[model samples]
Target: MRLARFRHDGRVRTGVVEGDHVLPFEGDPGMLEIIDGSAEQRTAGPVPLDDVKLMAPLQPRTLRDFVAFEEHVEGVRRSIDGSSGVPEAWYDAPTFYFTNPHRVYGPDDDIPFPARSVDRDFELEVAVIAGPEQSIFGYTILNDWSARDLQRREMQVSLGPAKGKDFASTLGPWIVTADELDPYHEEGFLDLWCTAQVNGVEVGRDLLSNMGWTFETLIAYAARDSRVMAGDVLGSGTVGNGGCLAELWGRNGKQDPPPLRDGDVVTLTVDGIGSLTNRVVTGPQTGDLPPVRRRDQAQARAERQH
Candidate 1:
């Protein structure tokens, strides 16, 4: 069953997407509840899908995005630090970072370019919605929006890329229950064919199986010293084969389709899960920040620029 959260008649509602329509749940149960088989009853007949506005699907309790793909780390590292070798530390385990869950977006939502970014990029990947215990509820296409300029500056400090990736992340169309993808399962991955298109031109394509770490391993690591709640989300990070512009630039040393501009539309389509699309828009402007606090750091910066 494909599950969706949408807005209809001025109220947010939950439903099961079947073909071209949606069967809204009685009392509009939360997505996690429906995933657990809590609400099996429907209020009325199927509503035409095109009529209502689909939401981000899951209101995650936590958003943990992992770098499960070696190729993603390899090329992105070169783009950021100009290094060709993969870090030895990355081989130890699945590494991830927490992002603000309150800032999530849905299909057809407009993503704002970060004020500091001259380049707009998107990471094509899959995400698993957590179910009861350690089980995965389902899958959804993920658009991990990136701001390369601010990301580089953050990486130089060895601490954060918070502002770089914090602005927006689009998820959904709907969630495809794990059982719906049973046929694509191989080894441990769904091995689905995924593609990205910018304004109707196909830019990248890759199989989900290219990632080195399995979802189960990543989930276990996430829950190792802690706990993952029912509505938590875990990302597969960027798949290989030009999933984002930075990776392509690192690999080819040239920008092909160039960075995203205001009004540009990005669509990520995956086998079994359908498409997740969004538009880009200019963000609000802000004032400047204060200079570096430490005199020694300021001197080092002058020397580096010199």
Candidate 2:
């Protein structure tokens, strides 16, 4: 079953998608309740999908994203620091970073270009929402918007990516339940094709089965010292060879392409899951934010003090 959250008849609702229509729930059955098996699938009349505004299927309690693709990790490392070797720790265990849950966007929404970000890019990925008893409820598309310049600077501190990634994330068209994908499971990975498009041009493609670490393993690691609650989301980081300008530039010997510009539309699609598209728009201008310090300036200032 495909579950969707949308605005209909001047109110928001949760419903099951059928063909091109949504069978509206008789009551507001929260997504977590549905995942926990407490909510019934009773429905009212069908509402045409085109008639309602889609919303993020659910607001997750927390979000963890993992780098599970070896090729993607190697490519990213080579792109950023000119190294193709995988870290020993990465092979030892699944590693992930927590992101801001409050900054989620829905399919078809306009994503504002972050302030001070001149190298905005998009990451095409798939994510699983947790269900009761350590199970996966469903899968959905995730677009992890990044600010490359900011990311490169902050990661030098030995900390994880922060402000560059926390500003925005997009999910959904709808969630395809795990049971629906059971037939495609091979070994521990799903046999699904994922792709990304920029304004109608295809830029990247990869198979979901290419991930080195499975979603189950990633979830297990995440729940090791804590609880994984219903509505928690775990993202499979960028697919192998996913094209972000950072990777593309490195492949082309460091010449940059124009970063995401205002009015550009980005679409992420997974074979079984639906497509998620968002338009990039200019965000509020930076009013009085301080500029980041340059390395040269900092060194010169230290010499003067001595």
TM-scores for the candidates? 0.93, 0.91
lDDT of each: 0.87, 0.85
| lDDT (10s digit) by residue, model 2, range 1-306 | 999999988988999999999998888798777877898879999999999999999888899988888777776776666776688888888888998899999988998866788778888889999988778889999888888777877888989799789989998988899999998899989999998888898878899999988888878889999889888999998887654556666565563555788889999888888899999986887787699776798889999999
Error of 1 at 70 (Å): 1.5
Q: Which segments of model 2 are wrong by more than 4 Å?
A: 255-257, 289-306
lDDT against true structure, model 1: 0.87
Q: Residues 99-211, candidate 1, lDDT per residue (tens digit)?
A: 87888999899998877688789999899888888888888988889998888888788987788898888889899988899899899988899999999998889899988
Error (Å) of candidate 2 at residue 122 is 0.5
Q: TM-score of model 1 relative to the true fold? A: 0.93
Instruction: Give the best candidate by TM-score.
Output: 1
Clashes of each: 0, 0
Off by over 4 Å in 1: 36-40, 295-306
RMSD to native for every prediction? 4.4, 3.9
